[model samples]
Target: MELRCKVFLRYCTCFAVIGALLVWPAPVHSAVVVIGARPYLERVAKRVVEILEGRYISGNSLPIADYVAPIQLTDKGLSITGNVSFHSAFLAKIDSIEFDAQKFSEIFLNTEVTVQGALKWHGIGVVLDFAANLEEYNGTGTLYVTYNQFDFPLKVTKPFNSTEPTGSLQFMSIDNSNKIVTVGYPNNKYVQLISRAIMTNFDFRDYMIASFRNWNFQNLLKAVIDEVPFPEVCYNC
Candidate 1:
């Protein structure tokens, strides 16, 4: 009886400890909004820019950077915020040909992304993938976004038809060439460029661009951080 009682007492103690851990509230939701540029999102955007440019973008931070949101922890779901947009998504490609045009690229996407998982709390980044079309050139690549120091690798390819050597589509007027080549395209010419390049039933570049514009992880995270009910990590689980 004595031995049985001891074993029972130990079992009860273990259960009590387990109960404390289970009932413990998930630390708390912490979010912050930064007016200045954020490093993680910047890295993601920079990678996107590099992919667009056909070469790695120079500098650690984009010349123009906007911060949106931070990661959010909530009972309902994990929500993140922020958006980073560039004036031009152009790559410099020169040919010894008749026209002297600076290669500029832009992306548009319609993205609805919501994910739920246990975060390491340190840092991790995940880059989404999307199809791409730069003027007449079409391809697929990844958008590398990160969180808490982890890098997310996303590569989306665009399978384009074997188009003629020459094709024309309107481009964003981030540079002078786009202004000159505006015809048969809407004033907001993301449509024209994407339409001509993909040459398929579905448009991946535009879709991805829309997704990146609204929730490029960094911006979403920034927004979440900003909207978080607390600053110093109330429940930093």
Candidate 2:
């Protein structure tokens, strides 16, 4: 009888432990609830912009350095070669950013970028070889270059076991009005000459687009998204 009582007590204790375990509250993870495609994408875009504002955008300038490789283009049987470089450069301002999400995996981004800094160029043409320098701080020679309709294609990937999504943004295209707005008096004639050469021979739009595309924000985006709780399964997104 004693042995039977001991076994019965042991069984009761195990049952009590199991019951407690079953009633214990488990840790709950929050998730994002994607309702509509556009709304969800807008949320993502806002988050992305917030990240950009924190990392790239500071006060009124975006610190950057851009370069254009030596370009060779022929015009009217004239060989033209040149390279443009932007040093101590900074994006003056971002007029606007528009994000169009085609689907959960693809997005099209468009923005207008204004950059200011020291602009240097070297050009060799059939008639003459010239070089120029334009600095933002130079009171006599400051130029405002605008890259309009800067378009980029973004590919989003959701890795296995990762709730957050990462994006790869690539340079798709850019259109420049080819109008260099001179803000100050001209101090160097070579600046104008090289600017004209760059406008005519080299595609400065491509250079700007390539430079912006090189800024990889995949990890930054993922980290930001991870912090925000989204539904594990987005039915609409």
Candidate 3:
């Protein structure tokens, strides 16, 4: 089942080249991200999730895809902070993951919600990026077994290339139970003012760093199911 690199490349070539979709001038002093209306937020969130999920789930059969979450904001009021977890979900167990779980397993998506990111504007609409570490995702059910696991991290680069709004995230230091995924913002004055000019733009300077001070062994559970490893793959086998 190991796909040769050339074959993989040819097969994967069938899919579109993936990247962000935004282009824009540098930050303007008067530009402030305003939270869109509730309905707008819902629509934008759905579109964003679909873009990401589409790429991961069907585009190329990525290791993890098909993201699911609730439909409400976690906070009481409109979020204009740093980031907000607008939705959430709980699966029966983490051990049930396969390369094509969405095509097979019956996964349940939760409708819980949370928020934190600034409700900034990107010309097209409101934006909130949650560049944080995930907490324990314990599995719970009456007609099932018992398990404990944490949700995996799925970082989003700025939407399409229309804004040219580019940012980078990197895994910084790690502690006992946590790991900090630093999202650096080079051009945002708000981020610079907050981080004291500590973050490096593409370097993930001080943009957004989700700290993980304690990491469980399960957090590192990555399954490599490929009989052949390559940058791309063809499934004509």
Which of the numbered candidates is closest to the native, going by highest lDDT?
2
**Clashing pairs in model 2, backbone N/Cα/C closer than 3 A:** 31-229, 31-230, 31-231, 32-229, 32-230, 32-231
What TM-score do all the candidates reach, one by one?
A: 0.16, 0.51, 0.17
How many clashes (backbone N, Cα, C below 3 Å) per candidate? 51, 6, 50
lDDT of 2 by residue, 92-195 (tens): 55555656554233222232111111111111011111222233221223344554455555444444355555545544555554543322125454444444
20-111: candidate 3 lDDT, tens digit per residue: 21333555455212233233223333343343344422322222111222121223343222321211211222222112112111111132
| Best by the TM-score measure | 2
Native-to-model Cα distance after best TM-score fit, residue 90 in candidate 1, in Å: 36
List the candidate 1 regions with Cα displacement exceeding 4 Å: 28-31, 35-237
